[model samples]
Target: MLVGIPLDQSNNTVKPKECASEMSAYIVEVAETRCKRSFAKVFNYFAPRLRSYALKQMGNEALAMELVQDTMSNVWQKAHLFNAEKGSPSTWIFTIARNIRFDMLRKLQNRKEDVCSDDLWPILCEQTADANEASLDQQVTLEQIGYMFESLPVKQKAVIEAIYIDGKSQQEVADELTIPLGTVKSRTRLALQRLKGMLHDND
Candidate 1:
């Protein structure tokens, strides 16, 4: 495993869960022995990516870094709770970061409650399903989403990535992209429809 976080990992789209068994071992070691090396490996590999993801969502370097710290702290504290059968570390870690970002957004957008991130992008939950209860837990891995998101048209994809993956408000996306708010909304709606159809077709 890498001992230090790289300057950039944009080209390494497939690395996160590609070695799930290996990463899982690191997580286990961190849990059982509190090994700093193992935890460092996890932090070294994921911290950069998590920061980038958080930066996109939160739109500030300092806030993005906070998300990374908070997420790694949770991974350290909750490693024993991880279940490999349910999801890989990438999924678990990113989900934690996303939920944290959600809370951060909620705080930041106190005046914009009429426009919500959850309405634009559904949050992924890692809960196990009950014996008699159905759940909407996404089994789709980050790699799958990376490829699927790339399939969108340039305009629609930009809007979707900004509002959906990045956790931006529709108005924020519109302002950043210099497009009309209605155009952002229209593209987002169309993009989601296509994405849901693609997901069902995959199923």
Candidate 2:
């Protein structure tokens, strides 16, 4: 959902200046303008995922709910502190979740409720940093691929759109276009080659 439409890093757009990561653009918007609509989008998307993550770590529905609420509160409060150069939005958000989990567990331990620090599994900040790097790279690459689709020749674009975007099989595309399957395959292959060359040149 976050990947398809690249925006222009404004209230009305998604593309950021340095990177076209959608979440990052959203975060930056929240930071600069305190836009509740953007914050709500962030909340709606990440809340359930954070609840699942917190439930896995804490093994309690109540704690999971708490984590989701607290983590999102921190996200809104600290959105201005987000540095997109360091890690993706995922890592930043999860790091907040991890810290909240730690604090929750630590408090439980203080009450002597059988929780122990030794049993805790904290998400390593560095590890998540690397993971988010790969994630950010993948997002940018996908955006570039979207750009590539705009440059395809008309016939090739039709074929590629039918197969990939419209989720039609090659045979289906062949029948729809009244062309043989072999011709469909050839057009697909040539369109892919052009996209490959574009990728290489961009690199």
Best by lDDT: 1
Candidate 2 segments exceeding 4 Å error: 1-20, 111-203
| Deviating ranges (above 4 Å) for candidate 1 | 1-18, 111-203
- Per-residue C-alpha lDDT of model 1 across residues 9-36, encoded as one tens digit per residue: 3434555456676678889999899987
Clashing pairs in 2: 7-14, 7-15
Would you give me the overall lDDT of model 1?
0.79
Cα deviation at 77, candidate 2, in Å, is: 0.7
Taking all chains together, the TM-score of candidate 1 against the true structure is: 0.48
What does candidate 2's lDDT look like per residue over 88-179, in tens digits? 88887887888777768879777754443223543322232223433323223787898899999999999999999999999999999999
C-alpha TM-scores of all predictions: 0.48, 0.46
RMSD of each: 21.4, 22.4
